[model samples]
Target: MGGSYEDAIALLDTRRRVRRPSGALAKDAARDAGLKPEFRVGGEALRGKPGIVGMSGWMEELGHSPADVAALNIIHVAGTKGKGSTCAYIEALLLAHGAATGWPRSVGMYTSPHLLVPQERVRISGTAIDERGFAKYFFEVWERLFDGDTATESQKGERPRYLQLCVLVALHAFIKEGVGAVVLETHHGGEYDATNFVEKPVVTVVTPLGRDHVKQLGPGMKDIAWHKAGILKSGAVAISSAQEEGLEEVLRARAEERGVFGGDVKVVTGTEEPGVQGVKPDVQMGNCAVAVVAVRAFLERMRGEVLSEESVRRGVEGFKWPGRFQVVERGGGRERWWCDGAHNEMSIGVAGRWFVDGLEEGDRARVLVFSQISDSRDTEAVFRCLAESLKGSGVQLVIFTTYDPDQTFSASMSLDQQVATTTLPSLDVYERVWKELHPNAEVRFELQLAEALNLAKRIGEPGAGVDVLVTGSLHLVAGTLWWLGEGVGGAR
Candidate 1:
């Protein structure tokens, strides 16, 4: 397959074969594919099979096996929120400590739903993979698994889903680059996630659990916890952040059944003061605590030594994960934009609280640009949670829009996003929900993201201070970042 980076992206786009079932069919599919089944919902099922059931076959097609995956010495992370940030903290700590240990020359991290490009999903030594490297490894995997024997000019054969293909490319690139360890974040659920194919991780971490991915994981928190805890190996240490009352029991039960290190799970509460600037005090500290505990466990359990406190502090302070709790000033400090990918009901509250807490006591016009693409989510409840957070702020403008930033930017929206946008009937729900909650505030819906941002900018023109919060969906955040020049090659 002779393909440039553009060609690679075009082919990758084809993998988003959306099959969204609804009504009774959705319920029946969920019952048959979720809860008792081993595979994730909506994955292309093998004939007579429940789900993908172990990504081993896909790995073998790419010339990798369980043994190969285990060699990466992965630190598996799964949860409803903070997975990416936790992984970022872990990678930073490992890099800060690796110099002294002289063991790991490089560390690789694999996370989902990139902010700008697909290459952002794979990072080595805390840097995103460049275009050349991305295309090189992408086609290598494509040739083996997607493109059949080239000698006979056979048509493109079977292919993994878009997210599945990204995982394979990251793993292959990590192996080729000779990284000593990989911090792997679960795509969604853990039981049958493509990343769960790793035979064993040195340690397994579960961030704070909440109601998310209900279509695939649950209608309840317990159901979601069961799927998340599936990442814990038989002998690996399971580290978790403080969860709701009785939720820890669910994790412990899963650990006991999975035989994880005598069924003992370590629960950690964050430091009173995180000592990190430009980070939220409550949520960031909790995520930091989980990361610190995970790194300490990996070192003490695997290397038989404890990490230095100084290294831990430096790592935490230096950690950076874009498109989540990110702040940027544009138009010569005349306008400010706060971006966070808070998609679920639980996280929307967190994002709102953070925004409210961080606001300066000024008469700046507050504008909200938001959108949610998940049909499984309760848009009204999520908007209500946000409304509660914004009760005190004099926010009178709310703009709901699609994720596509600009119609001319062909690569702005991913294939999955395109499908989701088409499925979304309209923004009437968002407008109606805001009207019911904030009766006096104004609400606007824009089909194009560029128009939304323009409207936001116009609401708070230059020379007049205005604070804008962009939240709800990661795709929306990504587009905002592109427009704001805050991503990849863009300016801060």
Candidate 2:
């Protein structure tokens, strides 16, 4: 007999024979009908568009249900740094309180770059939709938006973009799956970000803003702060980390102008022992405080008002975010490494201070495997801050490494200048460029990451105790972590 519904069911059954498979047949039928499990409403038409202002026009064309759109509970977060960590903490607290959550974060969490797996971007509760299911949703939404003929009003002036379509697919998935909340991390300035299209968020959180993304945002902190503050909605509560003197005022005025109450805007302050692994790092305490305040504000606005001081306390104390001063042991305790995503000068200074205070007297050599992109403003300043912070602290060695293969600009002279500016002799900046640029260089630059890490590990013996901090960019952290046998965790 020709392939019928029963045959499709059998195929699905074979795919899931190991599990208690019962939904196989229905799933297969959905796939056969051009409905993939994952949803990508726009496909490649939406990737890297200039701004979010144009997104509204495209969204209107999709004909998505207004009621479904209204049901979306969004938490929009934007800042120079700490945005990812804050989102992670908030997501974890909500999950603890029994709410289903979805996060749209940077980096390929579900999909690989340059690959055909579009479903990687649309994840339901941290799980990417399967291939068959992804195909089903892709076609189903495609047909609904643009009739099967692919010739209609939808075809006129329609552009193929990835980010725009990804947002649409995520929203559609959230509506279809009935998720209670969605946490969105903006790619750039919040004012024109696609996530801003969602109705005013219930709560908007701003982490510490600093000088970064100069090309898109601006050159200084004030300008960057304004762009980030654009996400604040009138009458919506806003929570922020303690800001610089002038920057705080700017954020406050913006919130006030929008009619967002000044009193409702809470700034995270004070400090408590992080209590993670029984090691109380000072920076962790500050982060914990900020998280606590944000969660309390969120719970206070809940319908039934179920949050309590004790519950909030427990949630904050129990929070653990990897890649933020994370220390992992490899090869059965023979080697140790620290991973942190501190890219900007302020964060780098903070990390340096934490190490200075935490390091024991007469510890083994301290090595830094650092790399950054060309766009990072004040690369020299960041290195100087770190070098100055470690002065007279008995740090044996500082290794400067480059990880980006496509970097057009070099910060080599910047590092050299910092050493002269600070007059610090204990710090040394090593460039991998000579080997990276040479056609016949003995060591491959890409593979040199492993060699650099292994060299650092070999330098210290167990008795002396060395600390290896892998930082600069999230890309570097991701690469190093993968090599060390640790999978990157959820959104943050």
Candidate 3:
């Protein structure tokens, strides 16, 4: 009562408040005497419940026992990057297997940081759960978690954040739907993430680790590897894509500690062999190799048989995880747009290299639309990566903006886009970086997502190999795709 809403947000944000939302009934929950629970912080808790030591109790408080989750078979995937694609591969493999046997007819896949829509996090039979069903199951879980005797310690003031709530809701949906298999991706590192409480998984996968999530997962790849390794369980097989130099040893040690013997730890090396034409060259074959081996291991362990090479290949080849390096042409527009959610240095570097490769050693009228998450302070590095990618190629235009509405969030777009007035101070920081790197390429700062797309369209020269790239963040890619009218509800 003593402070304004903005003041309250500032105070709670500065406090050691949880990273994600606390699912607490912020208003009714008692904090200290007459003090409110700080609704502003409560809202942020939905986004970042900071440290991750609360999921075990929160699951029980939600009336979901360990056995409840165990009812559905799960393959937990964790890593800094490529986790979503690996999860997609695992899910596709399970779905193909499910169609063949009565064992698992429905597969549910859950991944974090939804590309576009909120429902993208939870998919049933390879499609987003319908809006009605998502809301129904969502509030049902919310009620059971906070209402009556089911109130969690969070209710006393430790509410769950967005990722935890989404994971719980997804688990609820999968169990209720009687899904045969669920592919679960950890929100952050595995050890402290909510999904780590799965108790048991048929198999655990560590996609190639990198330097992202530095604020929470610590700085180096080893520290991040330590956290990602938490998904490994004693009896479950462990799998990993080739990690940078010494990180593989760290993964092996973690797997060994989790009780996976030497033979059980599968390390993949460039599994995407030559002659794979339809796939993007930048797509890591190593991650796919990890996914395939994981699927084979899970099937042999759980069903006592391995899928045929043909079936596994089909599954992996057919898997569609959007917003990686996706190309789209809007309304027969003259320019071809390629989009990748490569926010970190490594990923952006890969995306940039791919862009250069596609150019055939020639320059083009290329446009780069980039935005970074507000919290990550590595935009300078990202700009450098882009510069490295476009080194030989002639770049025409560069745009900087927030994930904010250059395009308004509406029904035509995702209603869940949650419009807010936030400025992109990072653009100013990046502007300096761009001048240092690409002194000639024109850089314009736009506040609206719509304006950015429109500007690219008007100025983009058609025909002679003009390329427009949207990278930096998945949120940016998702918003751009939605603007291009790719939000039609379907399995893809």
Candidate 4:
């Protein structure tokens, strides 16, 4: 019945000690240890467990002050996609200005489906919290939640332990590190999300909203947009990307209704005078413009503050994020690989357009190795977009692979089934229109990434332009990276 900090550490350590290295074995051990058996956002198991619907009540009970929390000077971002990239840019800008920064992002940034080491979920200044610090803070927070009680009457159906614990731990780490600015990327709808407990933020940024997480949020764009817009507070600036057709109007109306100044809500479409990076890529304009506007708004709010425009520009231009249009060079002058996390239809179309229009004729061969989770909406459309974009680009095979079966939301299916059902049909539709438009192009699909990459390497005619693109899901990119000897940081 003892629930002391020491006891909790010993318990967690014992649980870890007994888990095997293989995923299946570890899952079994977790079930045996009475852990929930279902999956959670960060790739942790939460089978048959209750979830915290909202953190508002909990934050209030803890006597946490929003003003004191705002004193940490944080920017909160929520979106279905681009949240991680945006957060990375903001963090980089703050770091360039010599401010201590803490960023908690989704999908292997802060937490992942599995943790090879626990410290990856909590970090300060790009370094994981040491084991001692992790244990110290984790137990300190856990004891407070349990109130150092022993054998208290067990609540029949209390909040699941993991979600509650993660919120407390994150808050504790942010406070302990004395982070000057913390950038948080939220999961699910913003209003009820764990991070929503914070009081009025300086600025809330929303990236483009699309059809995703339909089961949890809703089926329509308006519903999803409303959920994302939940972060906006009266008088706080709200920034968003230029929407498609009526979407922008919907957002503008919402912000107006909330009494936020009309000028405070900025919608970015494209930028003039393209800036030169080491490489020129498509979507660079949109991404850069969004980052620039958001950063400017935040800085303007702190007018008398010490942030400078030059430093902000430097931070935005110099920020680096892997697996989001990342181009890695191979040894021996082999084909280069472009890795991205364009799992949805819109993103794939954007990437395809970039490759076709940006790359020079003699630069690199474009070969796509794509895979996605089964539960993804309109994946067939995504494949079609990629194919249409690369119609006349001399692009080679479109290799199709299955994402990690363990971490995906959909039921497991064979690689062949995935290609036969989704990728193949999409390719056929793409070909029917493509052949009439351009008869010189060809598209084929393979069931394995390794084989596809090997084929691409062999098909390269020595000096011929050859670039391999691996994308679809973050898991697919992470898996390919692991095979290529790159460290999957969260997976150790």
**Strongest candidate by TM-score:** 1
TM-score head-to-head 3 vs 4, winner: 3
Candidate 1 residue-wise lDDT, 398-483, digit = tens: 98877642121234543333422433334676677677778888988777777788888888764468889999888888888777
The 10-residue segment of model 4 with minimum total lDDT is 100-109
What's the best-to-worst order under lDDT? Answer: 1, 3, 4, 2
Which candidate gets the maximum lDDT versus the true structure? 1
Q: What TM-score does each of the candidates earn?
A: 0.88, 0.69, 0.83, 0.71
Q: Residue 364, candidate 2: how far off, in angstroms? A: 3.7
lDDT of 3 by residue, 293-408 (tens): 88778888887976766667667666787787778875464567888888787788888888767663443468888887646436777777777777756667888766652232
RMSD of 2: 13.5
What lDDT does each candidate get?
0.77, 0.55, 0.71, 0.57
Q: Which digits, one per residue and each the tens of the lDDT, describe model 2 over residues 188-210?
A: 56655656665566678788788
Model 1 ranges with Cα > 4 A deviation = 21-54, 149-158, 272-279, 405-426, 489-492
Q: Give the TM-score of candidate 1.
A: 0.88
Task: Estimate the lDDT of model 4.
Answer: 0.57
Clashes of each: 0, 21, 29, 10
lDDT of 2: 0.55
